[model samples]
Target: MHRCLAVPEIFSEILKDILPSDEPRLNGTLTSDACHLSLEGRPVVESSEELYQTLLALACTCKRFLEPSLDALWRTVDSFWPIFVALGISERDLEEMITRHRNPYYPRRNPYHPHLSDLSEAQFKELALRLIIDADYNKAQYYLSRIRIFKLHAIPSALLWAVGELSRKWGSPLLPNVRELHLTPPLTKDYLIFCGRRLVHVSAPLSADSPSLTTHSYPNFDSIYIPADNTKDTNDVVSSFIKNLPPMRVIDAVGCNSMPGTLEVIAAMSSLRSLSIGKFPDLSSSPAFLSPGRLLPCLQELLIGDIDLDLCTQLLYALEDPSALRQLHVGYLSTTGATLQKFMTTVATRCSPICLTRFTVSSNGPRRSADAELPYSSKIQPIAVQPAALQPLLPFVNLEYLNINVFTFNYDDGFVESIALACPNIVTLCLNEHPEYIKSRNLTLRCLYPLAKYCPRLESLNMGGFTFATGPGKIGVDGLSRTWTHDERYDVVPGLSLHFLNSSQVGVIDRCLVDIAAYLMDIFPKIRYVDYHPLYFHIRDVREPGWNDWK
Candidate 1:
């Protein structure tokens, strides 16, 4: 063996790199919250079995490879098969267990493989009871102790009960060092027993009737993630589930429905620092609470999606003291020019002017050409957003990230000037949502001047609808004679941080590419990537005479 291989720590890390990363999901599909909960029935994909077999073979080949291979193999477990196999449970016994126990809830689709119907609380109970007699305790302890993450979406209740029973018998939790646990629906209080002192993150399904765990069960956990698909989960039930938990720092309930009493319940959780919900409960009907800052006092990050203008406004109003807020992401917004103006006004009034750093809003604009022909589509026209709509947010001078992805805004020089002057610390400014759906706009390449001149730390800029400029006030012009007067400081150097400029969404006429290139290079000296793909533009060929100048 090599000298580096003699070091178990280094070799263990090498082996770990070959294994799958933590919480591998099925079909690469992610939960709405991006929480990692393993799929039911399918734990280890066929692709990974070859690697696991190699590791197993290496472990058996030499004493030097045993510890490291075992460490890498058992670090993150998705199913109970590994544990059962590690405990020296024979295939004959597993087959016998399945044969002996039968449940009416699930159909026996495959007799050879214990399918969904084969797994039930009663069957798991039998397995748990059998484990008490036949489990290889020493071998189980060796492998179970190595598991740091256990993510299983379809866990039988009896399996957890067995672990709890064994934990009580053994005087230690089964997964002693497990830090992250993602369990699916129908969680019981008994499952809390598996959560040891090291557990810090939990993603589980919760419902109103779900058994609640004690706050002290796993006090170390700081983040709790509940999925969006649990139709049975209501705000009241989620609130009840959270109320009993130890002071959590982060709670993500993306796409979860909010009830009348949900806000009060969330407001009372003073320890919460981050919250992500699907919709905002109607604050108008709910009982009035105390002062604004009093609710969600420590919350710093908030994400709300699938919301309308009215609910969005109400939720903003609910946050009185948003001095701690750092990030706000609103998705699927449905609003008009005036409603959007009101929403922005509400945001400026309710949120902390200084604390907010990152802001993103992506609207539910028409995705397809047919969507525009819908009956309700005519009622809400995509009107050009005025400077007044954004005027309210100008107070947030400390903003570093601002992404306004809506079809209503044709980001011209005026809008750029206002934003650049107001939020000089902006790092990323993305104005267009649908780059392919080009709207009629009078904006030209001159819009980039204010951004390059003012926001010195800016890096990424996405002005999707603006066309190349041939008009006056083009770059390198000395006079401030246009409609917008410039300061006396003509010698202000452009920020070198900008490396990405995406103008692929614009539909512009083919013009003098040399002039466009020269103008951009004068102000933005370090722009390395320029995406001028005409998504909605007439010039489809990238190899066109004028387009090659940008390359």
Candidate 2:
């Protein structure tokens, strides 16, 4: 009653239900009755092309299968292609795809039935440019153009030059669009010349004779970081670079021995907002940089290291008005008790009323007494404050953050109280590595309750090296003690709390973890994150031969 069907015909019907219809080969082959019968028992197509063929057969059978098959084929494309195949994509197509989406990769084509028409010349050129740079340069360039951030770690000169040339040729006026550029390089001149106008933020280790070094117009640049290794002549080169970059707002010259002339140039840059002279030679010792108020006028944030009170005083006086300086950080510097007292007294009187908002002072110097021979029986004499002391900072009533490190045999409660009184608007306080005098005479948690009561807006408190009250006979307890509990009268301030405890020894670490956990749950319930730096634990499991198997 019916004509016998071939293997191909049977197979065609089965594949129509399983695969999409756009695939061409199977559509043409399955028409014969013998082919249908041959494929009758097969359940699945094994390879991509086989699947594609099956879908093509379905598409030819009915127009309804065409759209779905095309969609499935396009969706499977990804970035990984063989070396030769990636090189084949044309530049124009690549650019078109990149402009439409952040990432673009090619779809697979069968070797026997190649579809080369899809590839464009533009896409190929773009790919070629990237390939010529870093082995991974194509991906890096994609991120740079699309994401606006790039960190080029040790780029080779030849590769850098090639990419620069390609960028110049094809890039739009704002084509590169790089916002942050961190380049550690064996860079060439061409690379720097190409990058100068486009880069807004830059971090690099530069040398005076570096071929990539340039003194050119760079209007958009806002931040620059120079290593402190620059020689005297190199300082001139840096100054020349700075002159070209008028928009620069921040400079970090940590460890760079900047020339005295460079300091003058820095002071002259009215647009400079923040500066760091960390761990450099004492600029204060050089009369050329210190005389006639050689300080950056517009600088709102400053970080200095290994300086002295005289230099500090010089800086305060150099400012058009000390009140305008909002934030200050001094570290690894030494100042005599007399000099420190004088400086503080001056700040209390002058900067107390105006713009200074933050202050941080620290030192690693040895502790000694101003007057060591005085015994417990003698009356303490008030230190005299000179007129020059009053010439420095007026008290800063609007001060928001204050961090002080005092190292001395005698701690003075009056000094701490004075600072707090001067900065009534304080929001954050950090006191650490103080001398024994301060430790012995330090204000207790109960004594500092006034700060919480008065400073309602306070957000963070750091009482460095804090010890809790211990047993009845002991004056101070370990951090775990429950003896020092907050009362109903005390308000719960919403803020971060940090505790530093001894964890170097095994016994200490075990004890500390238990105490720390208990304290966190009971006393400091507001903590958001815990950071533990175990000095004793070496993490032997990571280096073990069978670590992967163990996991």
Candidate 3:
């Protein structure tokens, strides 16, 4: 019945409450800075928890809203429990779900797992049959075919088998034209891989697959995402899947067997381009892993983690003819030794520097432990990056992005001046000290003048503290004194993602004002994003991605 007045307005209002903060974006006017899957700053759909009750009310309100309202409700199903719970099963049968720790779990597993595995196949089928036969719940059955994403992480295989059986009896594939597959432990151990030529993105954990799917190859495989795990399970399933994979470009084995043996298996695949290993917890302590040095020839991007000073030196020396490598994500610690200095020299002299455009050091490792005895003492300390250590990378003038989060705050004005000469092509720069550390009293805007003057291409920057002094005030320029014009100054970017809360004493941001907004914008004319938390400002080239993610 088209009897309700202002239905569209009421419908939009309902959508606002269901969505989290992305309200203005559904119309596609705002930039997609939140998407993590973008390649060249393209906009991708953002998925959040759906408001089931609100959308259901609209579906029942009128025949006109049935299709659109139901589409929004069932467009994405992260798990199977929602469909079952809504099917209005008996209280005793559904009571078992409360035991799972994840109470009212919507998109993920519940906390108190009632162990659905304890149920017999007949018990599972009984519940499945009820859901299929129930007319009220199954009236919107077409929505099942509308499901574009189905995440099977931690979902029981018996339940999947039940759904498959029910779908077969209905004369349709369980999930036809599904676009993405996120596979974790215990996904249908008996059934074969479901066919779907539409699927493009897949995130697979280093776990076992169903027996029938061990040698199965789904259609149109391009990118594979393997999450981090510490288990030493046999890689037979992973090996078989990769062996049968098509000419894929990206493979992320974050915590899987990232040893040389795994790389040996991956290197054989000539189609492989990017290999991300950001979670190798034991990369530093063991010397055996570095031996099979520089194996992947066609590789372009390498993201490694948990490497220390000595291990870094050894790894650099092992990488053979890394001319194709463009992006490097380094995760290691600093030392009082000359390891960093040696690394820069080797990367510039030994390898092809022209292709090395992006270099980043992973931050937020096990934090430095504070000392118990001395109230102000820190148990562990950071070995800060020195200016001299950056000498080797200076020759790589083609460098566009540089991110090192371990540099000390005591950098002199000349440190960045040298950077201006070394890599004038720098576009994105991120240098931050641990937030827990005391803000350097020496950090001043005097150093940043070099980037503004020399590296004209520099657009995006993310760092902890620079110009701790209040503005508009007198600041040194090339050792010369100059007075400016504001009450307070803050270099915090214009994004909610960053933390603007400084210690009471005032670190980089203090007594800030909206008046200085214009002046700061004038300095970085080409900058697309400034992630200074609690105060976000987006400028020209709004299509550019946010501060992180090298690509």
Candidate 4:
């Protein structure tokens, strides 16, 4: 028989309010003094702090919260040493670990297999071993058992090995409660395999250089983020880790160009739904690495960068009924207008047109000579670079978001009408961004009115480079509104809600840039924020409901 203690309730009750949640939201504010107002009479404060500090402070209030607060404190740890040190592991122990693994002849074989992960057997043996252990040992083990999330950032490779070996020796998990694991550079997969199904989410900057294991399984890993690593061993690392896993639902391989053949292997997996790759396969160099089997029927989100016409031909030439793909973001290493035309045409002819919901194309703008001059910092006048040929993209009726900002092109003013006609379901539209050109090549604000009239659900629009200077001269409120009035709110957005315009920076405002803050809100009505360049507006007075009346 042993003594037992339990708290009827914990600090979690106290923290329910302060933690981020949907209800009881934090509202915006504005100052009364006119001097404090920066842009269009709104108070602007310049400061920032880590969000968790508030929770940490509140936990310090009650003495009864000591254990509960400690549990919360150790819930999400970045480095393993904090928990290990809190557990009373000595510096000498750490030194011994580094020394042992550095021996070069140290036997790296794992003694205990994956089946030893059973909680009942492992916990009993560890308890029997620690029956007469010190009070400090009890405290250390208690905290180590509470860690729910662990994110290792460039930790010593030997330290990981030590934890793996020491925990296995004691028949307990090194981190018993870890639900998620993020490693900056994982030296080995032994630590991961050791945790078994306790690990739910894992992200690491993985490459071919990490210690490869031929036989291991992580059944519960549903989401994984594998950022690019420029190491030499692409094939072995991907195969060693990926082939043995349970079916994965989400895999993000953005910026992973060096890992050749990795994307195709992931695509073939039956459970794969979301995948993002750094670049499409360069068929000119590695045509043999292409996928020969059935297409990725389950794939829904495919964000591939640095693709050209040749790769477009290789990928979509023979594919059929790829109707499952819903979202796509295709970037380019370099592309010509003609190349884009061929690619789009091929997409229409070869693939299923019904499934697309969101699409984006990024561009590395054409190389300009030194004499290129404009208000743009690089002095390069963005030229209209629309594709030479056009086809009706009306088949993609389910399309909701369309962005082609980076690829510069010039097309007739009717192009917007065509887009509005084809994609009636579109909520966000971002056209190309080109510097102001002569009247002969320019399209005006009035031409976009049809887009507003047709697409009643259009939530956000970016006539990318349609500056006041670029468009038909100086059209303000009436013209900007485009007769778009709905539910007593501006009809520019769907249900009078707008989230983002461009990604970050705003386009040029040639006339009365000072009133832009007030102008955008009045014209769009639902816009809460704007990301314009050369001027940043907090827009507190207009955005916050009663902020102005506060002072």
Candidate 2, residue 7: lDDT: 72
Q: What is the lDDT of residue 126 in candidate 4?
A: 44
lDDT of 2: 0.46
* Candidate 3 lDDT, 118-230, residue by residue in tens: 44456645655665454342543454555555555444444556556655565545556565666666334332233355555666554454332221345555667765555
TM-score of each candidate?
0.61, 0.54, 0.58, 0.60
Q: Rate the local accuracy (lDDT) of all candidates.
A: 0.62, 0.46, 0.52, 0.52
Candidate 1 Cα errors over 4 Å, as ranges: 1-75, 90-139, 155-165, 230-236, 239-247, 285-287, 290-292, 306-320, 331-339, 342-354, 365-383, 391-400, 413-429, 433-437, 443-551
RMSD of 1: 9.8
Per-residue alpha-carbon lDDT of model 1 for 66-122, expressed as tens digits?
A: 876666566666766565555666546644554444545333444665443454557
Q: How much is 332 displaced in model 3, in angstroms?
A: 1.3
Worst 10 residues of 4 by lDDT: 25-34
Please, what are the lDDT tens digits per residue for candidate 2 over residues 123-224?
A: 544544565433333543432233233344432233244456555554432125544555554223444533536556666655555443233544566677
**Higher-scoring candidate on lDDT, 1 or 3:** 1
Error of 4 at 218 (Å): 1.9
Best model per TM-score? 1
